[model samples]
Target: MQHRHACERRETGGDRWTEAEREAVARDHRDAARRHRHRGGDEDRGGFRHKTFVRRLRKCFEDHGRFAGADLTRKQALRDFFEEILLRRRLSDHHSFTLLGDLRDAPAKRFPGELTRRARALTPHLLTTDAAAGRASSARPCVVLVEADPASSRVATSAVATAGGEVAAAFSSQKAAASVPGTVLAIVDVPDRGALDAVDRLVAAGLMVVATSGAGSVALAVEAMRRGAVDFVLKPYTPEALARRLAPRFAEVGQHVANASEADRAKADFGAFVGSSPAMLALYDEIARIAPSRAPVFVTGESGAGKELCAEAIHARSGRAGKPFVALNCGAIPRELMESEVFGHVRGAFTGATEDRAGAVEAAQGGTLFLDEIGEMELSLQAKLLRVLQTGEFRRVGEAHARTADIRIVCATHRDPQVEVAAGRFRQDLFYRLHVLPIRLPPLRERGADVETLANEFLKRFASEEGRAFRRFSPAAMERMRAHDWPGNVRELQNVVRRAVVLGEGEEITPEMLPAEVAAGTQRLLLERIDEAEVEPFWMTERRVIERAVAVFGGNTARAAAALEISPSTIYRKRERWAELGT
Candidate 1:
């Protein structure tokens, strides 16, 4: 009875009791048990609880006897419990113990070391493989496993660790952004659509992501790629396959880091613009001719036709290349703040203005100011702009003094200035002033055969950004690209190429990897054109025939008319009329 009480007291005191106190308790328990055995007392075996107590005491004695020479701590007791309950149950083969509480607060010194020893003992067989265990232990790159399902967490951790990566943390989508660090690669098991928000946050932080799910939906995979995942591995992945998939990505990540180290070495080479079409070459020539001059250049093109790039080229090649090159989208600024943004403003000029501020024009002094979407500017502001263009002088809001403008202006617009002037939406004088050195950028469709070159360029850029090993597009994919009309222009083409880079599973990008809208739109348009049988007006039919012939003849108008069995004079007249009608 005395020994039973002593053992209970030691168990209750836990790690707070010293080893000497534990030994004293054990001695007292042995003395009482021996006395009870000699007396053959049925009182100790009167109930099941007494029997269980005796059994626990005997097991403790056996464990202590086995490790009698070594010192034992309360943490070792806990570890033994874990090995019996968790490890024996196959809950986890390898343990990565992260101490949650401060060691200074620990009641005993040996607790931490005992726990560490136990974890070392359970190291799994798979972790001993050469490819799996050869990574640096101190500088291990963090691999975050995001899984809401408890059942898959162990499997994911084991597989990732076997691939020479460490599972830094595990989190559900709801907690991923807050828990994941920037350096960690987020591996998400997105089981449903609700997890997309978590995926989006990970992407916004610029963390490399790898998503998986049991569902084999290609749409989900595509969506994951669109949200900036580096790769998507389906569930039930073997350790070898997981390692193979991650190996190249790890190498590419190393390259990206190396490249970033020498980022300044990469110059904005004008030769980097990838296109050999006549229109592109002509635009390049125009940029070269006008870059050295201080003229107010006007760029016109459909949206996403690289008008801003043309502006950049001009600035980069000009004397102002060494100076600041400021760019602003006229359409993006709020109407109420447009004047204040363009010209200097004094304190108290507006609600949010607490101090005097220089406007964009003054900010670009001695440099080039690129005004994108200039047609979106209000007509009232156009007159003030014309004055600045004519006299190079302007005044700040709520200020009495006038300031001289010393900046060069480069403007771009997708709208037709003639149409805006006819509609009384733009001042004709301002239009004429801006049109002095007009340079119209041809759209992607008009660039003819440049699509493949631009696609490959974008493919390389996005692949490098994503840390993938994709090289090029398949032949069928290239044919599909050429067959489609890019209504969103170059921007659309860039997005498609980026999407393909992310979603492609192999080195070559396939048509199946393209967005359904792109492939479907081309097919639908082709079918619609083929099914059309209605006869149109003679002029309309003539225009259609000429357009088709021109496409077939690769934009040779003379050959186009000859193929249509019509005189070149009639074709030219119709084209001139079409141009006048703004078709």
Candidate 2:
């Protein structure tokens, strides 16, 4: 019972609550309730009701505080709501609270039983003054944001705020040294050794720290780890990354909401990859959640769905971001040379080995190694890769000495690893080793509405690159694109736009520039099914015949008119009219 009480005290706080102190806090709360009921005026609500706020408050409370007792539960809950929501200032005495509505009289103590009843029902019965009593004052275990550099502070602050954390204050090393009490976690934007020293000091003070750097070195990271940082975030990172690193730690301390709403907010694009579809957003959240670890990450996506982009984002968010990000395409390398290419060879080891060389593992020392098309690597190489992953030990080709790489492995393949394992093409043990955190990217076709957005982005980029006046997609073109099934995914879309930007002339890219199957849409399907029964306006039919003839003859106007039995000038006039109408 003594041991259990010690643990409970730690949960509530380091100093156990005295019976007098609990009664004092309970009395303070009752006085505040009285003031709210009698003298205080209410503020107007735009659309949100106080009840709705109460529901959210309870949900956040349950998420952050898993308090396990009825003895002081009401006091604890009311304290959390006031501190976390209202952010009320601590009383001058630090032993009790001030009443609401500027009631200058000191709150008088009430009987213990009455105090308990009022505290129990306080949250639901909170008046406008009770909840709005104090603003922006704080207490112990507050999460602090420390960024010395003024230029980068905004980014770091925005990241932490977007993650749903209540930042107590922003300070530098000077201010931190001045005020170090009761900080839960300090996310320091480290730009140099001075910041590292601050981190070490904070750690020494028993404050958890997350060190962030934009252009950091391996020495900084290693030293930060030695000084006891919980995690390291590379700068210019998304808010989700900062949030994820803090999430689990804050959950343990009863300062974070590790719920679905927070996870869903991370659905926005991460780094270079763009999408808000549930799957992509989930992938972004997963990356943010796992980027701090040194575990091997396996990424799977169809060809051109940007698997490599995901790998880069992971490496960027990880502690190893300051080091080289070496990438190798296992399928692109020759089978016979794969071993030497990965592990390297000494001079004269092979016919082409003119001098000693290092491979991907060595090149990526103290960083990340991204292996694309991993499933296509030969089976013999798979065993060697697995061995390295298992023991972090490897040997160079034709060399007696062994070598090890301090590198994180990120493997990617378009084919399903399970299917490959079943077929005996991929090694089962190797798959398991690299599959600790698997990120499967959805094909572009499955991400609805993202297609049009992606199309607009691509078109805008290509327009500037090609120096074209092209701006928007015509309504007909956008509808056709949205309806068309993109079998080739993002890569195919990029290529189609690139071709159109090069050949297209008008401001609006019309259906004429789109592929036959894509542009025809409903009409194309009808034509394919009915063969000869499809009808069209006379001019439209003429236009189709001329287009087919010109396309077939490689844009030779004379040949096209000859194929259609029309004068060359007549075909030219129709083409000019179409161009004039921006079609």
Candidate 3:
């Protein structure tokens, strides 16, 4: 009976102490409780009552040496009894299980079957719950985890589903390859080269694969990359870390698929101008307002500020969308042939006019005429264009009769039309006619919080077009992008994002992927100086010119002095003075 009692005590975690030791601990606990109660100083009545109850329980344990003999062999009996008492005392609380205290030195328990069963029961419920919650369309995309081990797969599926991704299906490697669509990006725990071979097959079949090995072998990861795996996340990763790595890729894939499926729907839709910034929203509203009108529209902005895109948007939304929307570059047309190109000519109109032909205006009759670089149009041609706008009629060179065109006109220029008009380079009347609906596009730098949205949109586009698995921009890359002034504007931003997407090998696009000028924020500073120059006095132009030269030379005093045709000492002195003035 004593032996049985000792065994019971051992099972119940009481064997670590002798009866005397137990009594000593109980006395110590009671004393501690009494001290706590006294520390309350009678003001904390509830604390005193709590401490008194604990002291009473300790005293009872010391006196009895044990609780009621209720299966003392059960390791959980004491815990259950304590939990019950805690509930009864209104102290019920859930705490994290301390593995060191709960299972230290105990024989490791294997309940794989129970874990597997629980995961299976939980996974579908989790997926169904997420679907009901309508989380599939949220910004964060979901990943479907697959493993050969049924238990591991179940756990992975449950975790991913709970994270708001639809687990399309989970199976063994062979089954996953056969059953899973090429669109489903697979995350596999590669056990060996054979597992890698399965990934290879999936890749060959045009599916995106991300393989992970808990062992963290570079060989497997490199091999996977070489075999066209989108990313390789090593284990043992927490659910959060894995999700972070996989979500963007999944989102990219889903976005591409959606875009591809709806190509027809998006044909007339403006290219992915993803932004909700106030400026962007306003621009969109402006596009909608003036698109259907037949009035002559003029778009003005910096070089890469997407003036052409605005023109396209106007054309796409206009009543003549189904008709040809012709574009001609006045600056690109040779000066000698600019008149013939604009007005069209008979066979004898000019040396190059081989046959009777139509001008851009005639070609775009009943549609839209897009004139880029209108400010660059020669002075003589500007007079003819003014006549065309005034009368809506033009006679082809050497042709007797005037041909009238019924077309909506859109013109874009990077130069300041008012300056040109004041300088007598452009006709003020023509400027007014073309400026019937003027749209001034803001530079990429001024479009707050739109950089990220535009970057993401470009990433999706280039990834699809290039058949790559590009994902999201890294936080550092995003910061660098936001810091840039984007002198070239949206067109420049689009190119940068496209380049990053194509060149980026990791799941995140880094600052290194950006152009050196943009990554270093040099362009931003230059743009700021330009802005300052606009407000500076005419006499300050010389200083501004020198300052720009210094910046171009990377603040090298000797180089800046050489560029400015001044001495190095002079450059240094000016810099010092500018510093003192806090310019």
Q: Going through the candidates in order, what is the number of backbone clashes in each?
A: 0, 0, 0
lDDT of 3: 0.66
Over 4 Å off, model 2: 1-269, 520-583
Better of 1 and 2 by lDDT: 1
Instruction: Encode model 2's per-residue lDDT on 1-583: one tens digit a residue.
Output: 3323433564666434444443444344444444544655342231223333333333333433334233243334434444533433223322222222112121323223333223222321111221222221243235566766644554454444445444455566555552344456778777877777778777887777888887668888877878899888887776567767777776655534333334335433364875666666777878899899999999988898998888999999999989999999998998999898888889989898999999888889999999999988999989989889988988888899889778999999988899999999999999999999988888886787777878898999999999999999998888788777677778888887888889999899898998887875656445446746566578888788889999999989999889889999999899899899887
lDDT of 1 by residue, 1-583 (tens): 4434544554555343344545555555455656766777554222213443334433444443223213234434433443343332233222212121111122344334433223322222122222222322435455666787644665565455555556555567776653344244667888777787777887787667888888888999898888888888898775557767776766676667655433322223455455766677677778889999888999999998888888888898999988878888999999999998898699998798999999988898889899999999999898888988999999888889889988788999999978988999889999888777889989887787889888988988899999989999888888788778888888999999888887778799988999876776567446556744674568787677789899999989889888778888988898899999887
lDDT for each residue of candidate 3 in 133-165, tens digit (9 for 90 to 100): 232324434343457553465445534544445
For each candidate in turn, the TM-score is 0.45, 0.46, 0.46
Q: How many Å off is the CA of 548 in candidate 1?
A: 27
Using lDDT, give the best candidate's number: 1
Off by over 4 Å in 1: 1-269, 521-583
